[model samples]
Target: MRMVWKTMRLRHVGMAFFWACSMLTFRSSILLTGEANTPELESIVVIVSFVANMTTLLALAAWAENDPERIDRLPLWPMAAVVVVGLVLVHFAGRVGGGALLPFLLGGAVLTGVGYGAFWGSWADCYGRMHPARTSFYVPVAFLLTAALFLAVSLLAENLSVPAIVLMVPLPVISLVCLVHCRAEVPDGRAVPEGGSKRSLLAVGSLIGLIVASLVLSCLFGFMWELTVFTVGSVNEAHLAPLVANLMVAVALVGLVLYARTRVNLDIAYRIVVPVIVVLFAVLPFFWETNPVALNIIMSASYGVFDVVIWSLVAATSYDFAVSGFVVGGIVRSLSVLLRLIGIGIGFLVTLVPGKPSALIVGVSLGALYVLVMLGLFNWLRHKRKAGAEKLEEGAQTDAFAQLDTSAPDEISETPGEEDAAPAAGAKSTDNTMPAASAKPTASAERADLDDEQALYTTIAEDYGLTRREAEVLPFLARGRSAKVIAEALFVSESTIRTHTRRILEKTDLHSKQQLIDLIENYE
Candidate 1:
């Protein structure tokens, strides 16, 4: 029961169902329109092209992610509501008959894209802000659900009239449920702290670029699915495809969950899964006509893995060091969707060529793969360098810790000229081993009897704009440590500690170290 409770997240699962339903709602309209003429789905290409979802989608993604207002607080529900309305409008419009097709496609289809942009932008922000760690499981589960939804749309929409409209009812209903459940969110990992980070995504360099590039390439895989289904009009085979797809998604999710639970290194998974999937996507489709079911299984399995990795990256990027998760994650995910829409648009154009040439598909796939492979290698190399650098820093810190014991005194040698002074009138020096004549500094005037108070440190630090490093130093000051002791312990110079204390004093408007200590006690 504990394991189940730990692994199962209602919001994640519900969001998956919600997102799938949203997509299916939009797709149902296409199915309804395609049913009248073009039994083979040729005019469906016209629907996609005429709507031209990519331009607006790309624009919306850019606008939504970069939108300054969303940075401070995410308006998740309102955005989702917009998405629901957009998809529902498309659904209702799909029920419109032949003569009404032009107006509906011209108007409703774009609204559906608009709705998708709003929902995806906000949801992607949520993923980045709240679900960084859970990405491995929820992503695949959502995708698997999406596969199930697509399969349902393919099979049920064969009738493509009232039944299709009925099928869409659940899409918004599930989304509304998703909205309700999302009121409470599990705490997110790796988010930019409140008030935002010190640096921007551009400051983080190639990492963001790499994540965006990989996601765009993954869109090619999605494009191929659309291309084949629309061009071939193999709705029956496509309908059955999701069964194997969902199964593969389940298997992949299990492995990912195990990896998540066990805390295993994902390096090997990263090195292999993406590249292998890219190869399969490029090569397998040629044979899709011969073995449609097998092709679907492969596609499903690839999608399962790809979705997990993709979302994980998005979440991680959202929580990237020194940057706001909303801006980074939102932008990256939005770009991914925009690129995907563009890829699908390209696929639609490809099918327009005589006989629907396979070469163009292969060429596009390979080009995407090649770019991804190169970028993956680049990212891998950079990651290894970063890990090595962190290890070195930890090793250095460990050696510094080894040299000093927790209770050790700040040596008189640390303070030049201290040996010449006689004991203070009332106070006593800690090390009696020093000459009885050796001087003790009075409390307020000079002596900092070291006392590091950890608990009170955070409160004090926050009250004054202390950075994380400065906050760490605050606790050591509470223990009444001299600059020398604190510096040695922190592996820094006494001068640096003096600088920090000065800054803290400036921020707190305190007169001296003793005053700061007194102020800290009140907070404690």
Candidate 2:
């Protein structure tokens, strides 16, 4: 029992360590730029790294689409980690070689960027898959915890006699260990999926909007966290770095924890709190001139809110799609990498702004307004979709009753001729009466979609005469259970579960899990 518990916990611990290390590395951007005075070095490193990271992340998304394998076996993670090690080696080589740091800096940036792309992709894949139901809160919570830990370490190491390398050790070491373990346990690599109907077009659109909005917001956040907050005034950057990092992370954590205990209305929060945040941004110039601490507090609080809200959006959309862990993970992580790159570039540019209040205010206000506009678009799509679903449900109930009453030849009964077989010349109808299988579903079929997923699974499978193994797999499929999850529950290989799913689909004449879940709704 103890061993099992430890095994379950190892991945979480390893992820915590990796994310904390990542937070530290992000903070180090200021330190790196501060030390390396050459302008050319900064530009070269940022541009090259940004391109490399984006390419690698896109590649992961593409590869994940093709082969939904587990993180450790994906080859991407191992290669990225190796490049990171090379980055470290280059950093030292530069120290010893003592010449133009441009090549080394660019090399380090590319390597580091590639590494981060893989690292985040894997983390997103694991966490998103394991906790699909709770990922909205979990992803942000994970970030909050890691940020806090990163801050604590920075503070302690500032005064302690520990070597610098110790700070960097956890990211690479713990992450590798976790990936290896994940590989061994889930060798098949597909995520256990949560079952559901196909998402509405509006729901999908909202998600795409979210991805775009988040990328923009992340860029602004990157600018602020990296350099803007620290440079607000003539204060101690080193001391302030850890303090602000802790503040942002702590406040975000506390806020999220509190929100978790309540029914956090996304629309309500956005309507109220976001305006206040916009107000703060409007007045950032004044705060920068007066109390940097106060400005930092406001910024930190906004970041905290951003952490919860953005992650929640991702989680909610993933639920809508009923996506596999690998697919969603790849999507989410790839966006994160791109956004971070944007943020870093934006933040770096913000640092170059002349020490004038007007320019700062303009930049900040523009960013806030842009975010607000994007958010409005996102909410509009979400609410519209939700309204459409509610309407569809009402229509479904109405149609069910109408179908039960009319007894059209198409709306066949559970036992078609059992009751109404009095001297009628007609061909026998199947127990389940879906229109002969086609790509385009009928209007009546659309009205039969259901929300009670488990019931749907049983109804469809029994009506179609599924084998017992297929019967066992059916409920999980109706629930949109991933191949990995179904495999584990049945104590079988993922390949076996996949085979069962294929047969079930074939026998039922259902094209996909989403269709199966929808199939039963047309009746009850």
Candidate 3:
């Protein structure tokens, strides 16, 4: 256990480091570009970013669903592809300065979009498949660490352009290294099964709902990113910008840690957190002109914390439904990614509207949408709970009958002297039966009766038929740890872990680590 914990801690540290580097690179580039003076250019850039991210998300969903095993097996080909394409397009677009470059830029957007889409989805699948149990802990830890690292890097890279870009280059390289280390882990196929049926349709609907929820949240976050950039430029005191952003990131990290330790329900977190986000964004415009600094700080903290929780929810939920294997899992994830892309496009369109307060309007609109979806999801979950209980009860009766048939011969073979013993045994069995029969019904009747803490976990287990060990390992996987780290921590050999992982995939019918992670992250 100690070893497992140690390995997990190390993995978390690595994730933080990688994320930090990525953030530093990304933020520095944005800062260098500065806020576009022209609304048209700003809109164009935002659209490009949105398109790039969306394309990447879609490709990721497909890859995770179809060829997940390749995630770790391959080097950072996809990452390299995205960066190379982006740089090339940016260079050519600058050089040509005409209609001809438009296609190139659009193509670049598609490349980056596809690359990142795959990257994010794959990352989720990998983590969920590898460390099913610790999805809540490791997933957030990895992201927080990355955010912190990136913030620090961004602070240092603010002044140096070449060095900053060069520093950023290491992120893809490091990601590649991690991928190499992950090769031995094997794919855990936990995607939901493919086929059209009432149950399948329900799964699809749930996936769509999740996607819609993500779309609203992503738009809000994207707007927040833009707001941060705008705030940095508008404020005269430049030094304060990074400080405020860092502080916000810190607060968010702390909140994530607290939530992980507490194992809070995603629903409860959404109920509490979404409202706060809405209120904060709604009031943000009031401060933008008068008290930008303080408002920026507060907004950063609120938005950052909300994002962390939201990402965790996404990871958890994805894993829950990923049990059907990659085909269904991929479709569900792809749809979600598509919705996010649509949301980004919508956000871009909103920016095109005439007004200085467009960002504010977008933020408020997103918040309102989030509230509505969250409320609907909460209500839907309540209904599912009732239905799930009824199903459990029905299942229990069937299980009892099957057991009785199988055991009848042994019972009848008992001698006359054993009749008394038989009755006692029968009485014991009856006692056990009553609870078994009542368990599902009771769980259905009361939401509190369900182990909501394990709602995501159990869902994945049921969907994929995961064994105890596989379920336990999933959370670590999501954290992006190497097999060695997992082995050391679990007090098992890497090969043992790999074997178990293979079984998990076979049982769940999934294709890749990213699919698994995405499933857990976005579990209903």
Candidate 4:
């Protein structure tokens, strides 16, 4: 936990500022709610802003795909400049007069959205440098802090009104500065590993099963958004929906902290998302007339909880594959936003349904959710079976390795020089597969090589001052095994393996696991 803070505190500030910039500038439901004065115009601006944001994200992905190295070359300050200009335009849109208003708002929306997209790409780059284990904690804490900061800024904006745009103007620059500091702390050019495109595809393909599920969830959220905006009478009440939702996310994050600390076996948040959504939507129709605000609470909370889950998955996936974060984040986030738009369209379409519209929405949402749940269960079962089979195979291999006689003829294992020497006259070899005369020397040579490698690992570990656990992890890393394989071998969590791997890198002053392997391979 202390390690997490030490490495990720700057990231927390950067991420919070990025999120707060979004809420302050374009997301109409939060700090900027009603500030635009022209509600109709504000809606147009918000929609266009999101569309532009999606397009910009897709474009960045394309750009990153064209040359992953380009990410490291691109300057951060320019993006910051773009964001500042766009923010100024957005902030002043409401204050300007008639003929200039539309153009100003439209331009500002484009720039803000574009800059927001750029920032996401940059964050993906940053997250790629971090380990998935640390990111699980880092991403959530950043968000929780973002929510708290938004709450404070929103309150200040409520009191100061139009002048609040002044408060938001500097956040982007500050965020950029923090990101620069973060980048300085971590090594660069490691984000785009070899064969990044293939790895990115594999990562995305692995998560494809969750796409429909995520889309359904977002659609349900849009349905709730539509209902909240159109039906709720008070502007404040309508906006409270997002506020409550953010708070719900904060609560879920606290639970996530507990799950991490306690090492809970249960999948605390994601698995329960469907059930909670079902129950909330089920009760929505009943409360439609009496207290539609309840609808706001339920859907917002669901979206918030799901948002954290999605972000964590994104971070973990990027970390695991060591692919271009820009590509992965851009693809997933772009699709997510696109789905939310489609869901909003569905929200609009449901109004045309005959009789009880709320009931129709609830019914459709629940049906889709039910299908998603079933698919998830099937996938889980298949994965469990496959894991069991893999465990069996691993056990067999471990037994095979254990059966090998490590001792060489003539006590060859005693010292490097002795190991290198030929077996004493007439010594029998352990292997039954070959003739005794030739096998004795060959088996001795094989054992010598193994012992030599083990000795190299020991020297490297001691020189790097690796901890006992890290030293245990080092040999597997040198042999080119992944964090998962090492974790299985050590009977520890994958996160623990990653943590030890990170420590090894830090102590050795190396940039990556590949570097650590190279050090071992090239040792004299």
Candidate 5:
């Protein structure tokens, strides 16, 4: 548990700061939230920003694929500087010309989106190179820190808007500095995976599934965003919503870490949350007017949990598939933002319904929830079928072994000399000159040696505190199996095997696979 915290570094803080700033762009903030007479003006500016963000992601992905060398050389500092300038312009334009300065506001929004896309895409690349164990520990802490930063900025918005804006202006630059350090920390030896066709089909499928799940959750949250108010009790308490929602996210992530420890089976988490989330949406319409604050908290907290899960899965998939992190991040996150925009539109339409608008919102929310639930069920069924097939295969092997043992005695007498020579094969020497008791010890000794070997591996795994998946990968690694071979044997992706191998090495404080095998060999 303590080792998990030791993995935290400046990279986590960088992630938090950039995310806080990006989120601020979408919300009601003094600096970026411009004054517009009509909702159309605000929506148009938001839509443009989102579209620009998606465009930047796809562009970065294409660039990474065509010329991988240029990713490291991208001009991030200039982009960050431009983002700050755009925000400042938006602020000034809103104050001076009010609704008349639509062009400047739209321009600023586009620049902000472009900058955000670059930063987030690059950050995903960094995470893709890292081990999942370290990532699992860092993500929750980053979310917690982002929440704190957001809370502080929100409080400052009411009384000291200038200082708040000033504080936020340098966040993008500081975040980039931290990111540079993170890149430096990665070893040159970790090779960038080559060619998209070589990537695992399972890994690709998992990536698509994760993206769809995220989009569904994001869309639902956006729908809820239209109907709910941010206030807790009074209007002033609205500012505290981000803080509260983030705290809940932190709690859920921490609990998930504790629940799975090393394995972090996200499928189980998905199954557990689906029904609870469905029930929450079902009851939301009833409380839409009675207690808006509670609805806000529930929706925000649920969405925040999914947010971390999706981010972590995206990072893991890039590493697993050996694809460019920028490519994976850009494709998945851009689509997520686009879907959320669509959801907002759907919610807006529901709001405009003549009478019983609450009933319409309820129907739409339920429909979305149904899609999400069906996806979970499909994944669960696939997993169960795979497991059953593996079990049947094991049973067949065991039966074959049993048949061989029963027939061994009859074949033993025909070649007594050969049988006696191969003592470790558990064969009985049916020689008339030898006692039956002498043959029994040879078989028992072979069993003892096998037991001893297994015990040694288990002891070493315990001593190093390896996660369940890491422990499973260790014996295969010690036996000199390639990652691809192990992945086939275990019914997982090669990238997944590599991740588990890396985690095992990290936990054992060893530098290479040979060192791990040597340790096991030398163990008493």
Candidate 6:
């Protein structure tokens, strides 16, 4: 058990390391491309694009909720078809550049949105069902890896456009493949007969709250992206590249590290991270007129941290919601994205108003908005928790404990039975009572509870049928730790970690780290 625990911890660390590296590379490349030419145009385009993406994502989320098993079984080809259509539109948009292109742009935007949205939604749903805890960890790791990849690509872009793009595509594709591999491990709802009465498709109140929360978060992101563009564009060359790169890398690394080190409950992390993000945003205006280099870097790091936290929480929570409400989870996720797009539109419109507020003012206002939204979400989550607890208590009082007692043969036979039953009853009573009777003290009960928790973990581990090493590796994969970090932690080589990961995939029947995460979140 100790070895197993150690291995798992090592795996977690390694996953974090590798993912961080990748993100750093990827984000750096994006920064190099300098996509934020016209603030208004960029914001508008992104808003439209995100809306489209979010809608498709939401649909995918819904599909996962309703039919995760089917999702697992299906190949990526169908989904790839959607992506191809979007890419084709993008190609056409590149060709037709005039007032006549508005409709085409809109069409392209929707396609892009749907294509990515479907994949994103499905990814979240898959992660929730397969590797829930890892979902949070890997998110940061992925960001870190993307950042790293961005930086690497940026440096090499002049000479290696084709190679860079090829490399970039593989990361997500590999992630997708991991999901495919883990399909068998995903819990099938069909195995457990549905017992509830037919009910409304939507959980209206919860869904509304989620959408609102998503909108606020999305707006926060959109605003931050705009700020980044503004700052980077305004800054001088000597200071710009290093500052942006550092900020991107720092944020990813910090988020990854913090997430790995912390063991807070997912809900608690959500509450904490959201408030911090808002506070950071609120203060952004103070530095707006300062050296563009310094301000941009700081804000980027802060936003980076915020993004990691928010995405992790969303990924985890959405999975939980999906399990409880199936189809509704997807709709809620999509609605959340839509809300975000709406917020972006509002922000863009606000910016269009003459005398646009300084970054700090915009940041502060958005920060305040974030706080308000978070408060609302906190309340909602609190209520959900309370309700769940109450239900569990009720269940314990009515059925669970009684079932436990009834499972004892001695208790059953003692009621009233034949002469032959006497010996059997005596034996049954002895067998049933010995373990419980021996475990009588407070400490014993505590230990028993710990044992129970371990048992639960073990049971979950068994469901994945991971070897002790593979189980250890599972969390690391979720955390997005690098192979090197994992190796160092495990006191093994990086190649060993890779080998373990390969076997882990085979054992769990998962294809990607994301799929493993989905399984953990949903079934565990």
lDDT of 5 by residue, 128-158 (tens): 6665565665666677777777777777876
Query: Which candidate has the top score in TM-score?
Result: 5
Instruction: Give the whole-model CA lDDT for all candidates, comma-separated.
Output: 0.54, 0.54, 0.51, 0.67, 0.67, 0.49
Residue lDDT tens for model 2, 1-524: 11212223445535556656544544343224333423334444445655675677667666555344434456645644654563564345345445645556666677766776676556555543332223433445556666666666665655674543456655676676776665453333243322211332333355564455555555555555445433543222423544565557556554754555432445345356655666666667565655544544555456555555554554444443433344454455466556766665665666777776446655766776777787777778988999999999989977775665456434433445633452232425433332222212444455565445545554454345343456667778767889999989987789989987877678667788888777645656
Candidate 4 TM-score to native: 0.73
lDDT winner between candidates 5 and 6: 5
Prediction RMSDs, each to the true structure: 11.0, 9.8, 10.3, 8.8, 6.5, 11.4
Error of 1 at 133 (Å): 3.6
lDDT of residue 513 for candidate 4: 84
Q: Candidate 6 regions off by >4 Å?
A: 1-41, 62-67, 73-75, 88-96, 99-104, 158-178, 182-215, 227-267, 291-303, 310-336, 359-524
Give the 10-residue window scoring lowest on summed lDDT in candidate 6: 189-198
- Local lDDT at 485 for model 2: 95
Model 1: residues >4 Å from true position, as ranges? 1-9, 25-95, 144-162, 184-213, 234-239, 258-271, 285-289, 292-297, 320-326, 352-360, 380-524
Question: Comparing 3 and 4 by TM-score, which wins?
Answer: 4
- Taking all chains together, the TM-score of candidate 2 against the true structure is 0.65
Query: Against the hidden reference, what TM-scores do the models get?
Result: 0.62, 0.65, 0.62, 0.73, 0.77, 0.59
Which digits, one per residue and each the tens of the lDDT, describe model 4 over residues 1-119?
43444444565547778777776555443323334554345555666777888998898888887467777777888777777787777667666746776787788888888888888
- Candidate 6 displacement at residue 297 in angstroms: 4.7
Which of candidates 3 and 5 reaches a greater TM-score? 5
Steric clash pairs (candidate 5): none
At residue 220, candidate 4 shows an lDDT of: 74
lDDT for 509 (candidate 3): 66
